[model samples]
Target: MTNFTLSDLESIVATRAAASRDESYTARLKEKGVAHVAKKLGEESVETIIALVSEDEERVISESADMLYHLLVALHLKNIPVASVLTELARRTSMTGLAEKASRTPQASGGRQED
Candidate 1:
């Protein structure tokens, strides 16, 4: 089986984003701007949460894929590389979760940590 990775998806998104909007959904989404792509990412996050709570494995997998795709698109819109995210994840792994949480400054909303 082919091992498809996030790097592969990132490359695909980059390529598709260059296409004419009429020919590619990724291109069209990029045209709509970052806020719109952020909205789509939020929608996918909700769907993923619902699927997770429902205990539907297939649905969870599907929604998670959508969420990741939307997330990558949103990152691309802002010129953030997936490698940068992965690097943060790697850095977080060097510490205990609680320690990592403690290291972060508390935001007004109590700082959401996705690590």
Candidate 2:
């Protein structure tokens, strides 16, 4: 039970996303479907990048939170449970990073990485 696993974040986001239209911003965004959620994620990601490059620690933390929240929203709209994703991650953990990289055959990890 890690305090801040990605699964925990997913649960929080999914719960908030299910709220009524006026209940929470997450709910409102969820109501707009995956496209809107993805748009928000993109915006937050840019904010995080800015924070990483030129902002203070607090700003980086804040923007990272925002990015994570929007990402969860997107994932929720797609009906993907955190547990399902974690299962995949757990599987990946069994392999070495380099081995995992090489194991993802040509067509899988983005078309062979252009040699």
Candidate 3:
């Protein structure tokens, strides 16, 4: 069995983003801009949620894969490296969830208000 990591998937998606649009769905999505890519990610998220609600483990796995792919595409569109996300996750791991949430300085735009 081969081990597949998010880094591996990110690299593959990056290559696809560079491929001819006619030859790569990833490239086509990138050409459509961030709004389109975000919409695709949202759709995949709904599908994954539906699959989970229906208790279909296989479908959940499939939709989760689609969601992750769309997420990676969105990240690439914004030039945000996967390592940055991982670093944030690692940092969060150092604190309890509630403590982490409490520590965050909410943005003025629809973010949590100061206590």
Best-fitting candidate, scored by TM-score: 3
TM-score of each: 0.90, 0.81, 0.91
Q: Considering only N, C-alpha and C atoms within 3 Å, which residue pairs clash in candidate 2?
A: none
Model 1, 1-115: lDDT tens digits are 6799999999999999999998999999999999999999999999999999986899999999999999999999899999999999898889997877777776832777554
Model 3 segments more than 4 A misplaced: 108-115
Which pairs of residues collide in model 3?
A: none
Deviation of model 3 at 91, angstroms? 0.7
Off by over 4 Å in 1: 107-115
Report, for every candidate in turn, its global Cα lDDT versus the true structure. Answer: 0.92, 0.83, 0.92
Alpha carbon deviation, residue 70, candidate 2 (Å): 1.0
Tens digit of lDDT per residue, candidate 3, span 47-96?
99999998578899999999999999999999999999999999988999
**For residues 4-107, what per-residue lDDT tens digits would candidate 2 score against the true structure?**
87778887787787778788888888778899889889999999999999999999999999898787778788887767777878877899877777778877
Alpha carbon deviation, residue 48, candidate 3 (Å): 0.8
TM-score of 2: 0.81
For candidate 3, the 10 contiguous residues with the lowest summed lDDT are 106-115
Error of 2 at 112 (Å): 6.4
lDDT of 2: 0.83
